[model samples]
Target: MTEVVIAGIGQTRVGEFWDLSLRSLGVRAIRAAIKDSGGLQPQALYAGNMLAANLSRQAHVGTLLADFSGLAGIEAEALEAAGASGAAALRQGYLAVASGLVDVALVVGVEKYTDLIGPGVEAALATTTDSDFEAIHGLTPAAQAALLMRRYQHEFGLPADGLAGFVLTAHANGAGNPNAMYRKAITLEAYQKAEMVSDPLNLFDLAPNADGAAALILTRRDRLPRDFPHPVVQVAASASVSDTLGLHNRPEPLWFAAAQASVEQALKKAGLSREQIDLFEYYDAYSIYAALSLEAAGFAARGQGWKLAAEGESGLQGKIPCATMGGLKARGNPGGATGVYQAVEATLQLRGQAGANQIPDARCALIQALGGPASTAVTHVLKRAD
Candidate 1:
């Protein structure tokens, strides 16, 4: 396999973006990444997105975006994996470059959550679940997460506010991120008093679906310009795994089996030990998911993932820093665009360009994106080419 390095990365600010169309957001990110890559052109493009078909009445977005971005001649396609759509597209770009199928591959994740209003968004979110079993029963992603949180709290004998730490930490980190949706750090008291979106899950517990896009340019390390301006951040390893889409079918609904296996596979492929992972960019669309991911990734013992957050062990200077760029909770979930954002954010950390969120001596980062609980898990290990 060829050495695939992230030559360039770009992203739109995460927010409602009511004025920006999906194509606009995606093309802006694409142009930025192309410019950042020192004029390297892509032989192929992969667009990751969710809800566009249902909400925007638009399908074939890959071709649509390609034409809109003025790259209609290039091969382009859209990848979808529920919320993990962005990472899935990214994986293809990585393979395209690594396999020598293309000298340069462009990957972009874009979503327009504000395209519609009212119950339409909820209906679209349910598209990721088992329509017959889950959606038919009116169980949405939030409702599903609420069920999981309740189960976790019961089985672990945790208090109602046990997950507060994860929420607080994400917001605290997001406060320092300029591209984050919510730039103000939230307080414990504020979290406690926040309105409940789903019972046992308040507004702060879930990441708001927003409109945003992120892009990355990938190529062989040797292909970079002679004087690349930044440190080399390579995709050391990439692995994706899947399990039962419907949460009810899993043996232990609380345990994210796919998430666990993806991380393990990524670690093995990277030839690095768990202790060497300096940071993690977890798909923290919900706080409970973050807790479960911590346990599943081997960072904490079973039924004890929440403790790491409670003890501030996942903070910037903790045993294993996580969600360093606010994560989905504070960064605002860009639907399918999240995985590309994670790659971009992780690359920043590797390049020592995260500004206030920089982790000292950071080298290796594990980034994971999950689709519908642990139904689909895409994990990647990023290392600074030192």
Candidate 2:
């Protein structure tokens, strides 16, 4: 199989863009990605989207986005895996290039979530869960994550103020990120006193829904431009796994077995161990999710994730530098676009373009995306292709 490298990546400023339509957001990222790749256009395109059918009352997003971006006549396919849709689309593009089906491919993930007001948007996101069980029982994503947070806290003896550290760290990192939604540094007092959305999860604990898009251009390693501004970031491995849709049906709710499996597969495929990963960008839809993901991904042992966070060694300048870009907590969650942003950030770190958040000599990074209460997990390992 050919080695697939990330040629370029692009993302719009994540926030509530009430002015931009869904197609416009997609086009913005697509155009930026093409320009970032030195004007290289792909032979095919893959878009990762969730809730376009219900959010916009529209379908055929692949062709629509392709034509809107002035890439008509190219084979465009839509890949959906709930909130992990973006990573799934990138997986397809990786296979296309790795298997020699296409020399170059464009992958974009976008969602216009703000199109629907409060109840409407909530309803659309709930569709990512089990419609017959979880959703019907009024279990919002926050509520589900809250249950996990409670379990995690109880098992690990996490301090009541432990979650405040994650929020504070994310906000501090986000201050340097112009594209992040919440860039101001947050205080522990503010976070602790914030309005309660769920019992264990507060407003500061959840990632806000935003309208944005992100894109990446991938090509075979040998095809990379000689004069490119940055070194190519190779897609070392990509793995996706699914668990029981209903949280109660899973044998263990405290631990995410599917996420663990996906990470193990990805690390094995990359021929690397957790210790080799210089940085990590995992799903942080909620602060507790970050802890759970770190443990499941082998960054920390079970019931010790919050302890690791409390050690002041998990931020951008910390030992592992988890979510140096502020992540979903302060970076804002654009749903489908979130995973693509993770890949883009990893690529930037590998290329030494992450500015203030750049890790010193960072060579290897991991990107993990989770969907619907950890029911679906996708893990990708990327390394500098030097």
Q: Tell me the lDDT of model 1 at 350.
A: 95
Q: Which stretches of candidate 2 lie above 4 Å from their native place?
A: none
TM-score (C-alpha) between model 1 and the true structure: 0.99
Question: Cα lDDT of all candidates, in order?
Answer: 0.93, 0.87
Backbone clash pairs for candidate 2 read: none
Worst 10 residues of 1 by lDDT: 50-59
Cα lDDT of candidate 2 equals 0.87
- lDDT score at residue 337, model 1, on the 0-100 scale: 98
Which parts of model 1 are misplaced by more than 4 Å? none
Q: What digit string (tens of lDDT, one per residue) describes model 1 on residues 1-386?
A: 89999999999999998789999999999998988888888889999998799878889989888899889999999999998999999999999999999999999999998989889899899989999999999999999899999999889986788899999999999998999999888889998898998899999899989999999999999999897898999999999999999999999999999999999999999999999999999988989999999999999998999999999999998999999999999888999999999999999999999999999878999999999998999999999996
- Model 2 weakest lDDT span, ten residues long: 304-313
* Top-lDDT structure, candidate number: 1
